[model samples]
Target: MRGTDWLLLWTLSLLWGGSFLFVELALEALTPLTIVWARVALAALILGLALRLTGQGMPPRGLWPGLLVMGLLNNAIPFVLIVVAQTAITGALASVLNATTPIFTVIVAHLATRDERLSPAKLAGVGLGFAGVVVMMAAGRLEGAVPAMAACLAAALSYGFASVWGRRFRQAGLAPMATAFGQVVASTVLLAPIWLWVDRPWAMQAPGAVPVMAVLALAVLSTALAYLIYFRILARAGATAISLVTFLVPLSAAGLGWLVLGERLEPRHLLGLALILGGLALIDRARAARPA
Candidate 1:
């Protein structure tokens, strides 16, 4: 990736990394389902307006199935899991665990697509990434709670599949913005009634500024701008390069947590992060050695 692309990736990473913190704040007043619903709903609204404003057009009919799958995997399940997990884990730690998405994406892409075949390098990367997760789980003294960590890991695994699944849209001739906007709208439509029935958010007390800001941040920055940047990178960089942002998000999250939120990072967490980065390097090295 070019320097500017790298900057964009890191910026995307920071936005996503900060999402955990925002979710945690929102969860104080809203249920996980409610948070997920609001996030996609608001994001869809914003993107819909933008699409109308720019005359970008709607997604193709052939792409709707893929979009629905991506919406459920990428937006609904993982979003809710992360929010629920935030009630139990520190935002930084959850971000680190979530960083494993690319590793999983590599494995899933190998299984799902014929062209995106996995090599020994990718296998090693996947193994090493999982190893890092195990090490972090065993070695780190994390704040919040333990079960939440498990939930976050599950969410990361789901994200891995979603990342790979998302690539199908390109073949369907849908622009990145179209796919991003459509998927959020799909998720909102699917989740809204469920959210209302389950969470009954209207019956709850009014949210304070912090929780309101958290929801807005999740919707605007994390969902809307994040997806815009994601598709922007996808259009320019291809899926593999775009997915690399997964590896960087943990570092950005940890740094932001420490600097902005005053959260402490234990030594084991750093060690786990090092292992993940090393695993990513190994994957890249393997790819470099492969004959075209």
Candidate 2:
């Protein structure tokens, strides 16, 4: 990966990391399903306008099925899982467990594709990254959060498959902006019935300005803008490099929580972050030598 790729990856990481913080805020007045719905639904609307302004046409008629599948894997399922997990765990810890996405991505890509084969360095990197999660979880005194942790890991698994699956849009000659818009729109369509059935959103009370604004940022800033950057990096850097952003996400989430929410950040958490960064460097080292 080049320096530019690293920069985009880190930028992507920060945007996604802020998702946990946004979820924290939105949860004050919304259900997990509702928040997840709004994140993708509103992002779909934002991206749709951008697509119109940029003169990007409708997605290929032949690709709707695949696009819907991509939306489910990449957005709907994991977003809900993470939001639900946040109900029981701190945003930082949820982000930490979310780091496991790369590990799962490595395994899934190995099984699903011939080109992005697994290697010792990638395996080592995954191990080291996950060890960071364990370390931070311990240091944060996070306990009795088994269900929450499980939800997060499930979300990570969803993301892992989504990374590999997303490669198709590039192969099909879709622009990142258009592709991002398509998937979120698909997500909105797919999730609409589910959210309506589960949340009965009409019956729910309005969440007021703060949470409303937080959800908008979560949708536009984190989901819409982030997916544009995501597909761009995936096109240039491949699934492995794109997925490495998860390892950095915890650090960003923790820092944001500390700064804004007054969440504690112990010295031990810093030590854990060191391990995560080392693991990401190892992943990058291998990517530098290997084919995308």
Candidate 3:
């Protein structure tokens, strides 16, 4: 990766890492569904205007179905699960569990694709990754937080599926920006009814200024800007290099959680994080060694 790519990668990590913090703050005044809906809706509006400014048209009709599925897998499901999980766990712990995304991605790819089948190193990585989960689960169990921890892992699994599913957009020659826009648009559409039904914002009290600001920052900085930088890094450095951002996200989230939220992880949580990152390193190293 170039210096610019490195800088973008770090920025992307912070943006995404900060999402957990934003969601935690937003939950002070908003329901999970409402927060998720607002996030996709606001991000869709921003990305739509960006497309218009760039003179890029909407995606083809044939792509809408795939985009909707991408929205469901990548945005709607995971966003809700993470937010709900955050209701029971700290943003730092959630970020650490979210780091298991690549581990799930490797397993999903191995099961779903012919060419991306698991190698020996990848198998070891999978084992270590799950071991990390077990350790984390033990930590959570002590706190009666097992369900929340499981929810975070499930969200990571959804992200893993989305990563594989999104390859179709690339194969079909869609621009990353267009794919991102279509995705958030679809997510907004999908979440609107659920948000209305469950949240019934019409009857609810207005959120405070801080939660509103957190929601806005979550949408703009975390979702919109982060997606832009993510694709930029993916395009410039390729998937393997871009995956390195996963290693940085937890660190950023942990630091921000401690500094801003006064959140701290237990020793077991730290041990779990170490194991998970070690697993990711093995998986990434194996991928890097593969013939292009």
Highest-TM-score candidate: 3
Task: Give the TM-scores of the predictions, in the order they appear.
Answer: 0.91, 0.86, 0.97
lDDT tens digits, residue span 33-136, model 2 = 88888888899888889888878887888988888998899889899899988888789877877767767787799899998787899888878877876776
lDDT of 1: 0.81
- Compared with the true structure, the alpha-carbon lDDT of candidate 3 equals 0.93
The whole-model C-alpha lDDT of candidate 2 against the native structure comes to 0.83
Against the true structure, candidate 1 reaches a TM-score of 0.91
- Please give the CA lDDT of all the candidate structures: 0.81, 0.83, 0.93
Worst 10 residues of 1 by lDDT: 139-148
Task: For residues 1-292, write the lDDT of model 1, one tens digit per residue.
Answer: 7888888888899898888778878877877887889899999999988888889998878778878888888888888888888777778888887777777777777888887788877888878877887888885346656677788878877887887887778767777788889889888988988898988876888878888899999999998999888877877787668758767788777887788678766777777777877777777767667777
Instruction: Give lDDT tens digits, candidate 3, residues 184-283.
Output: 9999999898889888899999999989999999999999899888887887889888889999999999999999999999888999999999999999
| Pairs of residues at least 3 apart in sequence or in different chains that clash in candidate 1 | 88-145
Q: Largest lDDT belongs to which candidate?
A: 3
